[model samples]
Every structure is written in structure tokens, then in C-alpha cells.
Target: MIRPDIRTDWTMEEARAIHALPFADLMHRAQTLHRAHFDPNTIETASLLSIKTGGCPEDCGYCSQSAFHDTGVKATKLMETEEVLAAAQRAKASGAQRFCMGAAWRSPKDRDMDKLCDMVRGVSDLGLETCMTLGMLSPEQVARLKAAGLDFYNHNIDTSPD
Candidate 1:
């Protein structure tokens, strides 16, 4: 159960109005809203690791990892659980409160779930919060990640189907 207090039914007009607000007005509104739900003085620090980089099939223009683009990024295989754990440990030593693992995938393959789960569990064992951006997930996949102790799922909503 996450953000049960927040409204999810904002109309497109309302959303557009919010987005179109002047920078200062938007900033003030954002801070006001944030303060209502959170301690404004608290800040979070996170270390991001690309567990799997490049060769994404999605044609999202914003990502350099898209295979359709001629980005210099070289595609790599999924990282081992040990490698990810090592990075998490380093992140913890560097004062990172969270570890973010990402993969350049439209959706992770079924075979990759084990490694992903293991990575999450390992990061959590180090006492740091775990987050991942593995693109879309099936219900079963989501359950597995939850079981493995994922604290957050960070998906980029690059566009919305209106």
C-alpha cells in the first residue's frame, strides 16, 4: 500500500494546468505540497547503478540506451548478484541511503528475474533501501520483487496514452 492518501484521478486539464504553471509558482506549490506530507528538512541520497546497460528495443527519444539510436553506449549482459552487491556496499560506505538498480529493458526477460531478485535482496541485507527500474513487470514478477524486499520501483513515465 503506497500513497493511499494521494489522488490518482487528476483530469488532463488539471494536469496541464499544473505543468504549465510558472516556475516560481510551481516550485512554491510543490514545496507546499511536499511539506504537507513530508519533513522538508530531510534529504535523501542514492547511488544509481545500471545493472544492465544499453540495447533497449524501445524507441524512447529521451534514453541514450535505446538501440534505435546511435548512442556510443555498449550493450552489456545482466550484472551478477555479487557485482551488484559490491556496488551496494560501496554506495553504503559513501553515505548513500538508497541503492537504485536499473536495466535498459522494455521489460525484463523471465530468465533475468532470479538475478534481479537476488540483487534486491543483497542490497537490502546491507541495510540500504533498494530500488529498481526494470521497466514493465507482470504480477508474478512484481510479487517476486516484493518478496525480495524491494523498497521502491522507479519507472519512467516518458509518455501517457491519452
Candidate 2:
């Protein structure tokens, strides 16, 4: 059986040994752990909406939304609060337990924070979990989001420090 204790330090050899375990044994262990912590038959549904698309300043090569890439995606201004709320309502009606909003900005502008907060509150009021991926956010912004009832925030980190 896999160890139950949480661990932060693991040697490369130890990790390699675990990776070398028999496929069937690995699957059994994984399934057992999953069933222990969660309902095996239950599924959580989520919907993702791009509230603001394209025109990102960052030159992340892998991202199609970056202005530096010619990915054929046109830049659009931020959506109106009413429109966002309407989308959230639709998401809830379609049986999504979680609604996620994404923007193409490297980071949201201070002025736009108010609008974002409004969107979060609106979505949360619909009894659906709210999440956002608005790139990097300052501490104050995070605090404001928490106050607005945001459930999760997603920020992707580069694989290498290039």
C-alpha cells in the first residue's frame, strides 16, 4: 500500500522506483486512494468562458493569445458586466457546478478590477463556484477577489526560468 503521510522531500531514486512499479499495481493503488477520498461514481462539471480574449502583452511562445503570436485570434475588449452575468446564468442552467472566466491580459488593470469583482459576485450569487484566470494579480487584487467571493484563481507558471 502507498504511504498515507504527506511528504515534501523525495529522493530521485525513490521516485524512480515508484515509477518502475507494475502497471496493474500502480492502477490499483491509484484507484484505491481515489475511492478513499472521493466518490468514484460522482463527477463534477465545470464550464470555462473567455471573458476577455487576445491582445496579451506577454511574449509567452506557447500561448496563442499573446500579441507576439500570429495565431489568428483577434483581440477583443472586456465583456460588459451584464453580458458576463448572462453567461454565468446560462452556465448554471446548463448544469455546470463551477464557472471559470479567463482573460488574455498579462495582468488585469486596476480599473478593470471593479468589473471583475462584479462578475465574481454575480456568478457566486447564482450558486455556482466561481474561478478566474486573469494572469498575475497583486496582493490587493487577490484580497478584493476574496472579498467578492471568488472560489479559485488560476495562474500558469512557465516550466523553465528562461
Candidate 3:
């Protein structure tokens, strides 16, 4: 059995120990842990709403919306608050436990951030959890979103800043 006290953020030696374990052993341990904490038959589902489409400025080569790439995706303006609310309602009706809103940009503008805050507030009122992936948000922006009842934020670290 895997150690119940195992920390998710592993130390170097702990990571090495895990990596040295056989694949079957790892899977068995993971299965045992999962069954202990959650029902084996339970599978949670959620939906994503692309609240804002395209027009990103980053040079992330893997990103289709990067300004430097010719990925054939069209740029669109930020979505209105009502549009995002409607999508969130649809997600909730479809039995989603969470609804995630996403915008394509390197960073959100002040106006866009305000709109996002409003959207988050609206979604929260519907009793559904709301999350966002509006690219890189500053500390102040994150605090503002949290104040507006933002449940989660997705900020991807593209790579080691090497």
C-alpha cells in the first residue's frame, strides 16, 4: 500500500523512489488509494466555455492562437457577460459539476478583466462553480477575481524560465 501520509509535492528522493517503483505497483497503489477515498464508479464531469476566442500575443510554439503561428484560427472580441452566463446555465443543466470559462490572450485587459469579474459573479449566483483561464493574471487581478467569487484559475507555466 502507498503511504497515506505521502505528500503530493514530492522531494527529490521521494520522486526518485516513486519513479523506481514498477508501473503495475504504482497503478495498484493508486487504485487502492482511489477506492479508499472515492467510489470506484464515480466519475465527475465538467464543461468548458471558450468565453473569448483567439488573438493571443505569446510566442508559445505549441499554441495555435500564438500571433507568430499561422494556425488558421480567427481572432474575436471578448464575449459579453450574458453570453457566458447562458453557456454556464447550459453546462449546469447538462449535469456538469463545474463550468470553466476561458479567454485566449497573453493577458487580460482592464476592461476585459472587469467583464470577467461580472461573469464570475453571475455564474456564482446560479449555484454552479466557476473557473477561468484568462492567461496570466497579476496578483491584484487574482485577488479581485477571488473577491468576485472566482472558484479557480488556470495559469500554465509554459516551460522552465531557462
Candidate 4:
């Protein structure tokens, strides 16, 4: 049964109070909530593949793929549609319910949007939910992605960061 106290929004003070709780206490609270709302015995898996690896111009300290960092990751062009589909196949075979494509970019260039959309379509055709995290996107770009039937568009609060 759904909890009667469930809410769609929380006040700042309520959020802060949760954040201020002791680590163990907070974890316990979260676990209790999860147990109440989710089936504890069920687990789902996802696979994240870097569709475009490295060469990001932004220098976010937390990222290893940034051009500013010497993480020894060489920049590469975007993976081909076939390559991405193969990875999605592997993921599905390994029991992943969703396939997430990630790119190390400040934002995908207009020239790259077509290829990105093709990748999303190919992955979705494989019977897996398609997701992408290609930095920032313009309104037009988002429309193209939506037209291609993208299931999710994951973005970070900080550009080019996790």
C-alpha cells in the first residue's frame, strides 16, 4: 500500500532536516521508505557506455575525461552506431533493463545530433530503454532527441561533470 504521508514536494527545512540527520539514521530512514514503496527482492540493472570518450574542454575537478586533466584518457571520436548497438546487445544479454549512452562533452555540437539520435533509435530497437547524457542541449536538439524516441536525457547540475 502507498504511504499516506507521501508527498510530491518537501520544504527547505524538511530537506535540510533530512540532510542533517546522522548517517546511519538517514540510511535507516531511506531503507524504510524503500521497503514501504518498492519490492525488496527485485533488482534492476543498467549499463552505461561512453558513446563519445574524453576530450572535454571543460576542466571540472571531479572528472577524469576533462581535457584539463591528465587522466591519460585519449580523446576519441564518437562510436559508430553499430558499435553502440553491439554494446547494447551485450548489456541486454547480461540482464540490463536500460542502456545509457554517455559522452564527455560540454554539449554536443549540432553536427553530432543526427548521429546521437540514430544511436538512440538503434538502442531502443533492441528492446531496451534508451538514455543519454550529452552535456547541455538546445531546445532544437531536445526536440530531435524526443522525435527519435529517447526515453531519458540525463544531465548534471554542473556542466561536463557527473
Candidate 5:
């Protein structure tokens, strides 16, 4: 069994050993580790709602939504509060434990921020946990979202510090 907290970079010798292992053997080992850490009967599920789509100013190479890419995805305005609430209810009915709202933009605008707070309240009313990934947010914006009952915020550090 692999150590749960080990983060050492494996040398080529270790890499070769792992490669020599059978696929099913590796899967079984991973399954055993996961079951040890979490309940076997626990159903883990999450759903994403694209509240705002496309039109970002960043030049992130991997993202199609970046201003540098011509991925043909049109920039869209933020969805209405009622629309977002309906989606959240559907996610809950589909057995999702959490509903994540994602917006494609550099940072949320004033109107987007207001809509986000309303969305959070709507999601909370459905008894599902709420999370947001709305790009880089100011401390004040963070506090505002928290006040609206947002459970978590995801800020992606897209690349290494180097």
C-alpha cells in the first residue's frame, strides 16, 4: 500500500517498477487506498453550472476562453437568478452533493458580483452546498460572497511559480 502523505518525486528506478505493475493491480491498489480513507458506501458527486461563459482577458495557453485563443466560444452574459436557481434544484434532484458555479471572465464585474450573491442565496435555499470559481477576486469581493453564504471559492494557480 502507498503512504497517503508521501510526496517524494520518484526516480527512474521507481518509475520502472510502477510501469511493470499490471493495470488491474494498480487499480485494485488505488481502490483499497481510497476505501481506507473514505467510506465505501459514500456517494461522492458534484455538478458545475456555467453561470457566465467565455470572454476572458488572460493569455492562459491551455484555456480556450483566453483572449489569445480563437476557440469560437462566444462570450455570454451572466444568467438570471431564477435560471441559476432552477439549475441548482435540478442538480440536487440528480444526486449532486455540491453545486459549483463557474464564470468565464478575468474578475467579476459589479453586476456579476450582485448576481453571484443572489445565486449563492438561491443555491443555499435548495439545501445544497455552494461553491464558486469566478476568477481572481478582491478581498472585499471575497467578503461579500462569504456574506451571501458561499461555502468555498476556487482560485486556479494555472502554472508553477517559476
Candidate 6:
């Protein structure tokens, strides 16, 4: 049986032992735990939009938006606030509960914070959860976004060797 205890200090060996479980047994334990905590049949829907496209300064190997890559993607300026609001509305009409915006930049400039906050507010006003992936954010930017009703900020570490 899977332990019901919640822990934040799992050691590497403990994690490895859990990973080494037989596939069937692992799946059974996972299903059991999932059924105990969540509705297995319910699924959340989210939509992603690239608010600013291409011309990123970061040299991430897997990203086509990197300026170092010869990917045929052309850089475009950030979408206007109304355009983003329309897209969020469309996403909501299509049954999406969350709307995510992405921008191709090393980090958003201080000057752009106002516009980004407007976008967040607009999406939130539409009754959809707002999320963004605008590269590294300063503490001030984070505070502004939080004040604008930003629900999630995605900062994924892509370790692909491609």
C-alpha cells in the first residue's frame, strides 16, 4: 500500500526506490492515490498563445525562437491588448478554463510591465485564469503581475540536448 503521509524531504534513494517499483504495481499505487485525492474523470482545459513571437536572446537548443538558431521564424512585436483579450474570449468560448501567454524574450523590459499587466487584467476580467511565460522576471515584475491577477507563471528548464 502507498503511504498516505505527505513529505517534502524525500531523499534521492527514496525517490529511486519508488521509481524502481514494477510497472504494474507502480501504476496500481498511483491510481489508488489519485482516486483518493482527485476526480480521475475530470480534466482541465487550457489554451496557449504566443503574444510575442521569435527573436529570443537566449540560446536554448530546442527553442526555434532563439536568435542563434536559423529557424525560419520571424520576430514580431507583442500583440495589442485588445487582440489578446479577443483570443482569451475565444478560448473561453471553446471551454478553456485557463489562458496562457508566451513571449520570446530573455526577459520583459521594465517599460513593458504596464502592457503586460493590462493583458493579465484583461484575461482575468474574462473570468479565465491567467498564466504567462515571459522568461526571467524581477521581483518587482512578479509583484505587479500578482497584483494584476496573474494565476501562474511558467519558468520551465528545458534540458534537451537537441
Candidate whose lDDT is highest = 6
Q: What is the lDDT of residue 1 in candidate 5?
A: 79
Clash count, one per candidate:
0, 0, 0, 0, 0, 0
CA shift at 115, candidate 2, in angstroms?
Answer: 0.5
Ordered list by TM-score, greatest first: 1, 4, 6, 2, 3, 5
Across 1-162, the per-residue lDDT of candidate 2 in tens digits comes to 667686868998999998999999999999999899899998889999999999999998888899999999999999998999899899889999999999999899999999999999999999999999999899999999999999999889766745
- Deviation in Å, model 2, residue 25 alpha carbon: 7.9
Look at candidate 5 and give me any clashing residue pairs.
none
Q: Quick one: best TM-score, which candidate? A: 1
Name the regions of candidate 4 deviating beyond 4 angstroms. Answer: 1-9, 159-162
Question: Model 1: per-residue lDDT, tens digit, 96-123?
Answer: 9999999999999999998899999899
lDDT for each residue of candidate 3 in 110-153, tens digit (9 for 90 to 100): 76778889999999999888889988888889989999999988
Q: Could you report the Cα RMSD, in angstroms, for every candidate shown?
A: 1.8, 4.0, 3.9, 4.0, 5.1, 4.2
Minimum summed lDDT over a 10-residue window in model 1 is located at 153-162
| TM-score of every prediction relative to native | 0.92, 0.84, 0.82, 0.86, 0.75, 0.84
Where's the lowest-lDDT run of ten residues in candidate 6? 153-162
Question: Which residue runs does candidate 1 get wrong by more than 4 Å?
Answer: 1-4, 160-162
Question: If candidate 2 were superposed on the true structure by all CA atoms, what would the RMSD be?
Answer: 4.0
State residue 139's C-alpha deviation in candidate 1, in Å.
1.0
lDDT by residue for model 6 over 29-143, one digit each (tens)? Answer: 9899998989999888999999999999999888899989999999999999999999999999999999999999999999999999999999999999999999999999999
**Backbone clashes counted, model 2:** 0
Name the candidate, 1 or 4, with the larger TM-score value.
Answer: 1
**What C-alpha lDDT, on a 0 to 100 scale, does residue 112 get in candidate 6?**
91
Give each model's whole-structure lDDT. 0.94, 0.94, 0.87, 0.92, 0.89, 0.95
Where does candidate 5 stray beyond 4 Å? 1-37
Candidate 4: pairs in clash: none
Higher-scoring candidate on TM-score, 3 or 5: 3
CA deviation > 4 Å runs, candidate 6: 1-6, 18-33, 158-162
Question: Compared with the true structure, what per-residue lDDT tens digits does model 4 show for residues 1-162?
Answer: 767787858898998898999999988988898999899788768999998899999889989889998999989999999999999999999999999999999999999988999999999999999999999899999999999999998998774424
